[model samples]
Target: MPNLNFEFTEEFALKMDQNDPLRSYRDQFYFPKVNGRDALYFCGNSLGLQPKSVKTYLEKELENWANLAVDGHFEGEDAWMYVRQKSKPALAQILGAHPHEVVAMNNLTSNLHFLLVSFYQPKGERTKILCEAGAFPSDQYALESQVKFHGLDPEETIVELAPRAGEHILRTEDILAKVKEIGSSLALVMMGGIQYYSGQLFDMKDITAAAHGVGAYCGFDLAHAAGNAPLKLHNWGVDFATWCSYKYLNSGPGNISGIFVHERFADDQSLPRFAGWWGHDEGQRFLMEKGFIPMHGADGWQLANSNILALAAHQASLDLFAQAGMEQLRAKSEKLTGYLEFLIDEISGNSGILEIITPRTASERGCQLSLLIHKGGKAVFDSWYAHGVVGDWRNPNVIRLAPTPMYNSFLDVYRFGKILEQSLHDFA
Candidate 1:
């Protein structure tokens, strides 16, 4: 049916699968089945499939806790007292950051707020916070409250850049131009590293340069980009960032987030921050003194004792990342996502009913592809889901599917193509 040089067939899919280098990694995860067949899972952008090793990894911690009781904090293969440190080296490799620059901590928004208290200090006329319009609700709320906390009205203090009329995504030049225009007035530029709904990857390095040129701080919410893209946070000079682990990292629901603060501020404890005892110097932490002496680097940002159970689960995933490595993962991600694009185009050839809103170039996106279904809209998505195709639907007729390289296969993309064609035929 595809007017192409290549045929879309199950045998063709099998050939591609046989050649894939990461194909074995698929067995490392537990797939959810529908109607007794492995579901065509393209939902890694929302929630990644569980790693098979996660159970055994979690069980080790459970054993430690049950046997050691309070002593578990200091004794065991993974001692709870310094449990969070286990993920830092792997996180540093994944994020292109120094181990000292990254910290495993609270949820994404919470870390954003904690970093904001130090970085989003607005003085006099440089009191505005700039972010993408329609940013994730939690980010918008955090920015709004941070503005109001400074006795500034959100309506006036928060600045937003919306895509032009009829445009589905923002351009890099447009974003950089706006940053140059905001100039001195913009106190901070915080946006998602990758726009969630449209699957647009922002030019973080260039944007950071532009913000710095204007004397404004730069930060990113990398919830969708962290494990999905190669993020050189340290080399890019990004001031700060936060991301959750549940999505692309294959960690379980509400797993703890990671943060990156540039090494320049690693020892600047003089900066104003909301302090906690866990952030105090570990050597004298038990002294229980009145004065708070913060620890060095991102460890200083910790507010509470490690969520031991969650850290154990998170380490289970980061371990795999360290083994597979981001470079190899990203190489396959581009090909897998490109194949998804090719299949979508084959299905939507002459008819313009389905629109791919994500950028076409591999460099401009991660693994997710967002489709705008013109007719039947949400109904089309429902039909797809009913047929064992697992993807997420955004509001106003958008279907976002991500065939993650870690656990997804070439055959999965091909089978999804078949399912999508059937869904369309039924809806049409």
Candidate 2:
């Protein structure tokens, strides 16, 4: 990539914003106001700002429920019985999969457990799960419990891969080497699509291949990746995946999550799954039969009926996504994130006060950048928050800033840089 000849000037940022094709999207979101102005928000990695269309979408569902009640399941605008199907096209587009391979249903963690029930088969020597060390706590718990559920000790049945000594990110070569070395003992290759703390985007295509090569199942927790990076779950030969909608998807907090199961397993009735009435063949669903006949594709994985209100809100965001398109969003994202990285480098300038632990390469990261402050730690993070820079602060000393392509602008990043410079100076 060639340089855009960036400069540390408000004029430059304003000019960049003026030239941005996606500039008008900023008005579609509800931002938190600081001192009566929109705060410089860079925490989409944690929780995205709500889209303005959410109210209208929710109201439509409310009206149907008020007038129809139980009839809402068959009548009215989303047809509560199959409301989640409406999000399939957009979800498929974002995930790079066929519509049947994707479904919007339970929360991320719950879906992870549900998928594990079928994918994590512990038998013979291949009974251990492989994952990244220091993964999100919820993932840690799920993996540990899954091991215990099979009457296996997590300590002996879980293989955790970590970064090399004195490094903040894991190397792809090391990860693959470990996969090969632990081949017969590994039963699954599960990890975040993008690391939550370091913000590293693993080479999932390669990782999936390695897992398959070892005869182990592969999956991903895309909580930090789905809308932030380009995904090709189907083409990548990934067995399964799951993600939260509240982060990059911009749905409301605690909104439903998405799941992906490869087409190969779509009609694999031999696979063991925790059966549910909702997953029974739709044609016979109301029959209330004694035998469970699973639906085809990702829908078969669903355990409950659609959450009409949540799907409505999710559908609202996915509408914007469909109109904007991933190709267009990603083109702008690379530039916006690259510009933020450039600005951070310019501000730090050999100061040894902070270091970027996230990968510097565009191919290895997404919207978020994790800055590890060497000196000020939490106090500096608190000052940044006080000054209206809404970024995610982790324990010890790391601040995660994500310049979301949907609602964030170059001017927002520039304003954030100024606040950061002020905080560093004040706390120096």
lDDT of 2 by residue, 1-428 (tens): 33478777899989988988888888999999867777889999999899999999999999998999999999876788888789999999999999999999999999999999999999999998889999999899999999999999999888899999999999999989999999999899999999999999999999999999999999999999988899999999999999999999999899999899999999999989998888889999998879988899999998898888999999989999998888888888888888888888888788777889999888899988999989888887788777788899998789899999999999988888898677667766
Q: lDDT tens digits, residues 1-428, model 1?
A: 12224346788778877987778889999989877878999998888889999998889988888899999988877778788788999999988899999999999999999999999999988988878888989899999999989999999988888888999888889999998888889899999999998999989999999999999999999999988999999999999999999999989998899899999998897788889988889899989999988888888988899888788888888998998999999988888888888888888786657999998878889999999988887888888877799999999889999999999988888888898788667766
lDDT of each: 0.89, 0.91
Model 2 regions lying over 4 Å from their true place = none
TM-score to true structure, per model: 0.97, 0.98
Clashing pairs in 1: none
Q: Residue 377 lDDT in model 2? A: 83
Off by over 4 Å in 1: 1-7
